[model samples]
Target: MGRIALAELSKYLLDGHLSRRGCLGARRVVTRPVAAGWMLPRAGPVRAFHAAPGSTTTATASQGPAVPLRKQLKDKAKQAKKQGKKKSKADSQTVDGWELTVGIEIHAQLNTSRKLFSSATTSFNEEPNSHVALFDVAMPGSQPLLQQETLLPAIRAALSLNCDIQRVSRFDRKHYFWWDQPSGYQITQYYEPFAKNGHITLYARDGISPEDGESVTVGIKQVQLEQDTAKTLVQTGNTHWLDFNRVGVPLIEIITDPDIHHPRTAAVFVRKMQLLLNTVDTCVSGMETGGLRADVNVSVRKTDDPVRKLGTRTEIKNLSTIKAVEDAIIAERGRQIRELETGGVIVGETRGWTLGSKETRRLRGKEGEVDYRYMPDPDIAPLVIGDDLVKHLQNSLAVLPDAELDRLISEFGLTPKDALSLITLDNGARVQYFYRVLDSIHEQVQAEFAASTPPDLKSYSTLVGNWIIHELGRVTTYKAGPLASGELSFTADGECAQVSGSDLSQLLYHLYRKHITGKVAKELLLAAYLDELEGGVLEAIETNDLWFKEISPEEYSVLADKAMAGEEKVLQEFADYIKFPQGKLMYLVGKMMRLGPTERIDPAAAENVMRARVEGIRAP
Candidate 1:
């Protein structure tokens, strides 16, 4: 007997001449069948054993049963097919007993006129390369100069997130090689970020009662100020062009702890953050335009794990929208679970989500701290914050979302849901418009109160909120340009309605006073779209022929006689209740309303006129 190669044994096993159990020298060789093929033990070379022709005995001293070649091949192929079928099933990837953990990183571009480290303009959607400055392009002699305006927004954002703002911070250069980065590095806060150890409380989705809704508090790890890189436009093939207009733009990266367990929770948190940032005028928070983006890190551990050690995490980068963030997290979690189930190790890497494919693809291996080689920049000095400056920044901060929401609820008497809805409207200008309308209404109410006629603030606030959130908000296709120009316009679905806050206030005032019907007010609103209310709601109503004429008792007598002509039952009913108008008030009002000058006439006034006419007709 000579030394036998494993390949030769595998060939013999495939050919049905050798059994799985065979003896070789001092060790016994065993081969187990696998899905793809066969599994063999790792050992040294072994002596060969030859089988007798048409016999189940080996040529050596050992004897074993032989399997037919065709049968063995068929069985192996069938097993492989079964394995493939199992892999194709989604149940094979089920991690029903695993606990999922997620963390998010949000990069929100600050709303500033100038770049973070340069005087270059930070306006978006501008002509390519036109807004780029010498410093933005990283010229040899150009040095970084920190923008003071950038700090205001960052500090406001930190306060909104309830984070601790550091009095002193320094800029560090994060070295990385990328064509989109002209400086070959990014200036960011590494050693000490501006804010840290904050938390955001997010409630469940809409329609869930506050008592029943569970609130999740996600911890904020840190909020750091950094400069944005230039935009990279990918062309045909491997060609990529860079636009430096966005280079050096200010950004605040908000990192969160691994407290998120559900996808919807992450979405709610992102939306809340966006609203808070937009409310403070920190960032536009537009995902489509790249004003805000998210990076989600997901990992899973066995639900039964006693030690509770976390599994490997995969970072999904640059999720541009809240929905994208949710989708990417769910898909990545499933991928990791499936890989683990298949006896495959989950790799720690940076992956990109292809929204079209709805799958995560590997971008690159994860980078460690040493990869960045962070160090304080020599050109820029450390930032020193005095108490006076901090107080100034704090005083300069506008009413944040939470404070405003509370005010709207407590002072204005708006419901919690209504207040939340008003503040979280997608357009920040709309939210501003809501407050302006509320203030104008308040002023009017105060004046009326001074005149000894106080109005219900709660009812008025509810009416205004409903009008803005439901009626005005429903004009989705309307032009939003006028809002940016300090006016509101609704020009879509064949309706063009544009009016300023004052014009709308006047219309609401007339309606509240019962001077005009809701129909007339709506018509006036539509008329205000094309022209400003020159003489206020009255002029608009008169111009549009929406005014209602008040009929006197003598005039209503003539009209009511005509309306009751040949209708003896209606006339008798009116005559029967002539002295007590309350009995037939509704009937008489309906008859008089038909004969009124316009539909905008007050129904109560019509009823009164009808009662006076009926009484005069039935006088003893």
Candidate 2:
């Protein structure tokens, strides 16, 4: 088959099955039947269909404009219609007989205070070996003591995935050798996961349908509670040192069935799962920090039969990011397709994701489940979670992104996309802070706007979300640990050192009442948080004049007009600034107000006046 034709088929398959379906926050339902008599293609160097053996696989010069897979599908569809009309031409030009099936296995790190079977802290960013406990280091005579904090969060996460949490669950040992894994065998929950049979909602440009999102309940083989390994730093001298801090951190291994059908779909599912996990404070999808990883299992076939016609599956391990995960799947798919097209076969093996080249390279070996030597831990008693306990957890379940999105839609009139964007956070605390700020703004703004119009949280939510994602993300990376030497800090026991909630609230209010845009407020917030966190401030942050100062109303308006006049093109660029005058003008007004007291401008009043002008811009 021509490469164009194969690309076209891939699209038809993706769109046909994933475009129109029905589902909303449900578990994966297995409905497709597996086909029999599938054959694995032989593996070898990939070559183009028309190329002779030993010919180079590199792209030739003078190819036309690159066509998108979707467009290729349309062209093929048109060609098919024309060919159907000419029986004589169809025999030579028509292409047929090919199928591809995909399945994905994702490993999501669980959020917890300590490791699964040890007291080693699971917190991110500490001294190299500080968090390591005796059991984590595999020290002699050390026995495992499972932490409820870890187990409970794992259970919640499984539930969040829409998986059926098994009523009875147990652990097993997974044997693997790597620098980070101090234990020869990782004790993991395998036989019974906390949950299974769940699904997540996904979105695509064409708008994924129920069937598209109705992902097959990729039978979760299990969701095991496990221990994470430590980090290894390789130096120039070929020397490696271990940072055992993360060695015993709690981890949940979620193993999925071979039910996924495409790479992008898998990416979407992983993202959805990440959002849910982060929302419930169950896990942090820390790609850079190795808190989240994926081992993708990919296979291909030439038959449309759901279960039949699969080439060998290759496992791509420890893909740290969503992009890497997606790219690996696509690359693997392309490889499989090309191999089969040239009468080559895919060999089952393990592969490593290479970000630099966006490809997967063969790993040494494949370790099947049988290699793990599943056995119950004799030291630790079986984990027994009571119904009442689960009920209590459900009752006290943290606000999830889904519920927050619903609130944004119903209460603030935010679009689903906007709501989802607002809730984006690597840590649950940040998301909670976002909602808190929104609630604060809503309480004040709603009462003021309620008599005339309904409240819209879009402005406040967007402002805060932007600040958190950008500014906070930057400041959090600073080396000095939030504040200076010491202002206030939280003890591992959960007690505050010097900072109090009232003081923090006052500092925030001072900044807010200054008429500061969220960006400016965020700068002040980071400074204040650091000061307070490091025991440097009690009343000092509140007394900072910069936090209370604002530009006067008239001065702000004059500056806004000047900015507008200086850039007429901006008027066209941000036409919405005039259309939604009140909401949009504030962003620009805030920019102008940033001149601070030198301009003696009150940004809040400047916003009102500038909004009045912009609102008039659209008037007859």
Candidate 3:
């Protein structure tokens, strides 16, 4: 009976004369595909497709008119079948399955001080109701006002996504029920969003080359400006609490097409978006507590023509971690596949993934929102952005994260991995301190070898990348923790804002000259960074006795002699090791100096003397 109704609905939509406005409107009716078998009740002249029960097949494209309606119906079926195949293919890449279509709606909280429609404070973690204004809470007689700061970021993100920013955009009501929502409807862009028809480049992990990495493109549908709803806190005793702190906060919703195929790629897309937003300072640095959240819609279908076995789409909600997102996508794909293979159909529903269990449970129906009944919010007027305003914003909008990542690679000579890591850690502030420190390091090294300039970037880029990602990472994380011992301190907001690049450059130089091997150089750098995190008086490791204490010069020489005296089998590699280039020799020195057995002397000095002995042998 359900299949018959769906086939009739598909026939009606195809046969009906839908006006352009009706076709384009947000309220267009959506009907699921009819499964094989079960004919519809004859009403008027509409014809429907039907097959015998247990046939496992239905009508094909060759038998029908290629009208938009027919194509949509046929496409839905094809999509469903492809979805079923997606599972086996995932487990074994060679398996044939449906292609997965993923659409992302990224909700980025704006970096602003006031709410969109009210004068309430937009600060995070304030007393729940303190930031709420009567107007924000939708109290009687309060009116909505506009906030320019909120709109600009949306426009910027739209531009970044290559979207067409509409000059006049208005808000509408999205009705829903939740304790956190003081108003029954959320004011959001629907009829016409702030931006439209944009795309972003997403690099799937597979797309990256082992030799040189690059990303592929993903299409974006639009970027819209919306007001955020209040948050609900699930209390301990099966009760829920409301917090209006987030009410009226400006938000930008970026919607993308189902171009993504893999969960990791989706995560990469999110990360890239976060980087772009943060670097431009358009949105709150995402992934921070209460900064941003995302909901993902994923569907799968087979590749056969007029495909009739389109797998169901599942909405995965509130996935905060990238890893979790990938896992959920994989798990959901598996769940759907297993059901289909067992002769059970996959249902289209909204689901939530619990990271702990790695399983997704159905939460609600997707078709329920077919009647969201959105209407214009007449209280607020449309935003009219002028050409002058757009120009100013286009110019003032900070450099994008992609360009920054590329620049970090070219200027600093970083590997794709290293550049990506630093950009990820630094966010939009990638330039403010990190690059400055790197540049200072380059300059100081050049000055140290004023008579002989430092080697070109290729030699040092990896070192710099490793130093920042590993050494500095430890410092940043530790300073935010309790054991941080340096002068600088992590602010309550958990940022190391006061630290400087020149400070890092000087500290590293000091480490290099103190006869600290590359191994020890990282240690000393981290130690000084610890001081920076504490927000106290700036001090170096030498001042604090944090440098690795060294053996006397005479003691080191005796140890070197002992190492060469016996164990010819073990000692054989050392002779050739000393003969290798400086780069290879440095690696040996690093191994010797690390807290490993074999040598008690400092590796750097031992390296210098070993080279001399090797040269003596070659001279003979």
TM-scores for the candidates: 0.68, 0.58, 0.69
Candidate 2 lDDT over 1-620, as tens digits, reads: 21334544464344222211223113232222111111111122211334455444433223333344465567778888888778434321112454435555656677666677776667666767777778888889999887877767887876666666566677667787776777688777776656666655555421232335533344555566777777888888899988887776777777766766655567766666666766676776566566677788887776656567567888888888877866787777777777888988788788887886755788766777876677776776767777776777677777766677778667665566655665654244444555555565556666656788853456455554554445445544563364444333343222233323333344444444454444445555566546543533334444553444554556666777775665565455355443353434666676666644543565457766776666666635
Q: Give a tens-digit lDDT track for model 3, residues 1-620.
A: 12334554564566532222332333423322343322222212222224333343333434333345566577779988898788544552212555555677888888888888887778777777778889878889999988777777777777778877788888888888777678888888887888888887755332321222356677888777788888888889899877888888998888888777766677677777777777667787576565777888877666565557545777888878766666777777767767767888777788988867757898887744446778999898888888887788888877776787678778777766767776665453443555565576777678878897566765555555666566666665653467554333333222454344555666655555553445545555554554443432134444554454667766555544554454455444544554445654454445445523432355657788655644443322
Local distance difference test, each candidate: 0.73, 0.60, 0.65
Candidate 3 TM-score over all chains jointly? 0.69
The number of the candidate with the highest TM-score is 3
State residue 355's C-alpha deviation in candidate 3, in Å. Answer: 2.1
Candidate 3 or 1, higher TM-score:
3
* Residue 160 accuracy (lDDT) in model 3: 76
Model 1 C-alpha lDDT per residue in residues 385-491, reported as the tens digit of each score: 56676677677877777677778779777787887887766445556677677788789889878968676787787777777776554333353334324434432
Where does candidate 3 have its weakest 10-residue lDDT segment? 40-49
Number of the top candidate by lDDT? 1
List residue ranges in candidate 1 displaced over 4 A: 1-96, 133-135, 204-212, 413-417, 446-453, 474-497, 532-535, 542-620
CA shift of 500, model 2, Å: 16
* Model 2 bad stretches (over 4 Å): 1-100, 122-134, 176-183, 205-221, 304-309, 426-620
Instruction: Give the TM-score ranking, best first.
Output: 3, 1, 2
